[model samples]
Target: MFDAGLSVEEPVRGVVLLRIDRPQALNALTTASAHGMIELYTRLALRTDMRALILTGAGESAFSTGADLKERAGMDAMAARAQHMAHRLAFSIRRGFDFPVIAALNGIAHAGGAELALSSDLVLAVPHAGFALPEIRRGIMPGMGGTQALTAALGPRRAMELLLTGDALDAETALACGLVNRIVAPEALVSEALALAERIAEAPPLAVSAVTRAVRGAGQGGAEAGLALELALHQRLMASDDRLEGARAFAEKRRPVWKGE
Candidate 1:
């Protein structure tokens, strides 16, 4: 779990509870965490069980405060861009998963963190939680999808205000701006989010996944644009464990044990 700097929990069937486990630093993201998240998504995609995902922070203080500035203090421009791109890649792979992703924002979500929440299908936040895109203050634009997703969510004017000013919005203001679905108490956040996820999980998996693809694809470039990109990703996964398991199972005449790698 720490290998990915994330804590993955599946207490309920077909529901994944993924936490950014960096409370000491407000769950700030690092390069290793981003890469590990992408790796984890690859494994999860090979599985047939997942129906929903609840992404949140490990502690009560923050969903994430964006990238680890301390870690970035000495990074060159290329390294910094690479680190941000890793997080974006992780986000993209997660979108490929055929399920709903609910973001339970515990507290402040700034810069990259806001972009991460925008990546989810649904968002729930605590009353005191905040949202913002403060990259302008740092002189670099959002390396993730803040420019695109934020505009799509809040319209050009609202998104431009936050992007240009780096101002933060409280949970209520976020709700007013249609940035969050609802505000949950810190204690009730997980249980309620999990319950909501379980409710969605009760539906037919294939139909739900088809709907997910249709809706998620609508915001992106659409299925037609994804064909070539999908084939490229499929080719990249040709050497995965699940692929080898199929050949091995056939030769030995036994059921394949999917490694999901």
Candidate 2:
């Protein structure tokens, strides 16, 4: 269910914590690690009890510095192409997960790392954390969904500037650009992220999944289509036992005991 390069932990019930374990390489992902992540997320997608996920690196030096270029340097064109496909698949699996994902960026997150943070529903960074899409400096462009996610998170103009310049954005600038949601001290990063995850885990799981789908749809499609999808999901949830429990709890001034029905 897990691999040496990745560690999966449940620090709190219903909240899964995923840590990239290659701190010595600044947690840069190797091909194996990339596939490991995809497999982990795919497994989590089937779990009804998994309410939230937190992604972070094992050490304070980096959340991830992106792909392992050392490993890439030895690869032939065919190998490189395969690696690229795996990277894209990993991001796709992450984006498709039903529960919320919180990226706890403790340090540098560049190129593929930035794309990982972008795929998450929320990003929390340490004060020293930085982000960038430095693939331009490597004589290539980011091929791991970086371009589109950056354009969506920051405007096209700003995203273009960063991608072209290959400049790093510090935590403050990332927050200003809406690339990160909040900046916390390195020591507080995990705790704060876990707290947020726990909070989200308290909601009815079906409603949470529906909201995620609706918001993602709104971002990818027209308002009319997005609203239609939201309405359909809402109508489906309206008939669930959890919906009735929510109403009853509100009337009774008590917390809703969601059965995920």
TM-score on alpha carbons, each prediction: 0.82, 0.96
Which segments of model 1 are wrong by more than 4 Å?
Answer: 219-261
Q: lDDT, candidate 2, residue 9?
A: 91
Q: What TM-score quantifies how close candidate 1 is to the native fold?
A: 0.82
State each model's CA lDDT, in order: 0.83, 0.89
lDDT of 2 by residue, 7-108 (tens): 989999889999999899999998998889888878888787989999999888889988889999999989988988887888888788788889999899
Please identify model 2 stretches exceeding 4 Å from their true place: 1-3
Candidate number of the best TM-score: 2
- The candidate 2 region of ten consecutive residues with least summed lDDT is 214-223
